[model samples]
Target: GGIITQTPKFLIGQEGQKLTLKCQQNFNHDTMYWYRQDSGKGLRLIYYSITENDLQKGDLSEGYDASREKKSSFSLTVTSAQKNEMAVFLCASSIMGFNYAEQFFGPGTRLTVL
Candidate 1:
């Protein structure tokens, strides 16, 4: 068993500022992911990394950037914060090389932009 941790549970950013969120997992999983949660929209994948320093952009990654420092850590950045925007960023991890590995999620980083 392992745990996923997100740093700075809350984030307050000014519009146009670049804000970053960090995540770390002790699960030693090979794959990590970042997703954005909107009020009405469902969870949208932002970025994923299959291995150390690898990157994959998702449907909603246009305005975001992600980095995988190693197999156990991943980080996300909001390129340009939007005004009055609120969203939650989630980090997840899954074992690789399996047919269908179940993913576990971290607490989440809540963002509020002014």
Candidate 2:
């Protein structure tokens, strides 16, 4: 059992700017994931990594990039932010099993692009 935290509780970005959000976990989980949650939509997976430095693109990965340089941390970058775009980015970690993995999530980082 461990805790997860996201840096910069709120993020403000400019149009076309590359904005990055960071997440760290003390859980030492083998798998990490990044997801985006819009105002009224369910969370959409952005990226995931099964091991350090291994990246797997997710449903919403076209406009984003992600990295897991260390087992304790994962980061997501918005390649080109869109004006007036707003979303919540969530970070999660889990010790994956063959079929079931219980994920623990961070508080979340809210993003606003002006």
Candidate 3:
């Protein structure tokens, strides 16, 4: 069995400020991802790393940056927090292979911008 842990259950930031969130997993999966979930909107991919030191931009990567420092950890930084925008950031991991895989999510990190 494996477990994923996300730091900072909640994040409070000012508009235009950069904020960061971190995620770690013990499963040793090959792929890790960061996703944003807004109110009434489905999850949108922010960034994903296929392997250590490899970064892949996602649909919402414009305002974010991600890093895979090692096989078991992935981190994300918000380039700038948008005014009046709030969302939950979720971290996920899956095995790398030809078959379909389900992503396991972290509890989530809620962000509130002032």
lDDT of 3 by residue, 18-60 (tens): 9999999998899999999998899999999889999999999
Give the poorly placed runs of model 1, Cα more than 4 Å off: 97-99
The per-prediction tally of clashing pairs is 0, 0, 0
Worst 10 residues of 2 by lDDT: 95-104
lDDT of 1 by residue, 1-114 (tens): 999999879999999999989999999999999999999898999998989999998889998999997788999999999999999999999988355889999999999999
For model 3, which pairs clash?
none
- Where is model 3 poorest over a 10-residue stretch in terms of lDDT? 96-105
Inter-residue clash pairs, candidate 2: none
What overall lDDT goes with each candidate model? 0.92, 0.92, 0.91
- Which stretches of model 3 miss by more than 4 angstroms? 97-99
| Each prediction's TM-score versus the true structure | 0.95, 0.96, 0.95
Worst 10 contiguous positions by lDDT, candidate 1:
94-103
Total clashing pairs in model 1: 0
lDDT winner between 2 and 3, please give it.
2
